[model samples]
Target: MKGRWLVVPTVAAYATRTLRVPLAGWSLTGEAQGVGPVTRRVYWIDIASPRRPETEVVTHLLQHLPEMIPPVLAAFRRVRRGGGPTGVGDRFTVLMLGVRRGRVQVVEVDPTHFRLQTLRQHSESGWIEFRSEPLVGNSYRLTVVSQVRASSWYDRATYLLGVGILQRMTWESGLRRALKVSGGRKAGHGTTTVEWP
Candidate 1:
């Protein structure tokens, strides 16, 4: 198991180097690259809670995301109605490590699920969804799924080397903190699973 674990970082380093080849001016169309147009990954945590409505849990999570996440890296807020299309088309922006990264549009919203898609030039492109599901007990499962494609080879390399890991760590920490602050105990360590397609 230790040797297997060690292979992860080694493979990551090799993949980063392999993807470092410049792809300047190259564009990626949504196509199957064995990873589809977007790579999909899921992260989830189970939080102990009273019998709360799924919508309440999701709403609370969304509203608290900005605060839960690392302040220096990202911030989120709902754009004013007059500023753009409201409701389902609501807009938001995310800063990557404190720099304006891209715009996001709320594409879908429901009591148990919310989805947002990137709208501007960004290192990665695609959508992310957050969902809440009732578990066997009074607790709930909060899951976040991200499907994105690297805009360039450099972006891909950066993701492989450190950015991806940082994002995962930040996300898991934020969720754990959010649960704790909301009077919920995390059932266990959050789990992140990556899928090529």
Candidate 2:
């Protein structure tokens, strides 16, 4: 069977009460960031939301690459479940709760290549649904892009700045955290790092 690829961007408003330290299980309060190794290249991802407001500042931690793939897989699971059967022309609803509430995008994932189609529409509780063949066994990469936006009228000057800064930071921090969690499950410990990509 031919494989189709769907690129669904799942953006959420999040608030983390504690910073999860990779492999250490150590938790920190406030805005703390996790750092880790993606092969020889070090990177990070950050998440900011009104729900988890305490994570406003940035700190550092360490992690590995093998640790970051599961959440991406999980994301696929959510989209698949919400949509229905994985097939061509299948439609689904995607729920995105963040700076913009009640925001949903209709998605169609082509089974042949997995390229996703999205449209802005309010859905049933902001659920994103789509149909596409399973990419679980297929060899491909999952890219996650998350950003935070805030405004207070007077502080609106830096609104765009916050998005750009947070997007890169959030992606890096999230990647590290994903690595630690995913890798820990694959391995008995977080110390054992492997090649990813």
Q: Which of the numbered candidates is closest to the native, going by highest TM-score?
A: 1
Candidate 2 versus the native: TM-score?
A: 0.25
lDDT of 2 by residue, 1-197 (tens): 12222112112112222211124321121101211211211232222211212111111111111132233322112223453334434332222223221221223233222222322221111111111111233211223321111222222232233533443444444444543433222111111113232
Return the TM-score for candidate 1, rounded to 2 decimals. Answer: 0.71
Q: Candidate 1 lDDT, tens digit per residue, 95-127?
A: 666533555677788788888776534556777
Each model's number of backbone clashes? 0, 37
TM-scores, each model vs. reference: 0.71, 0.25
CA lDDT, every prediction?
0.64, 0.24
- Residue 170, candidate 1: alpha-carbon lDDT: 66
List the pairs of residues colliding in candidate 1: none
Off by over 4 Å in 2: 1-98, 102-118, 121-142, 145-159, 184-197
Clashes of 1: 0
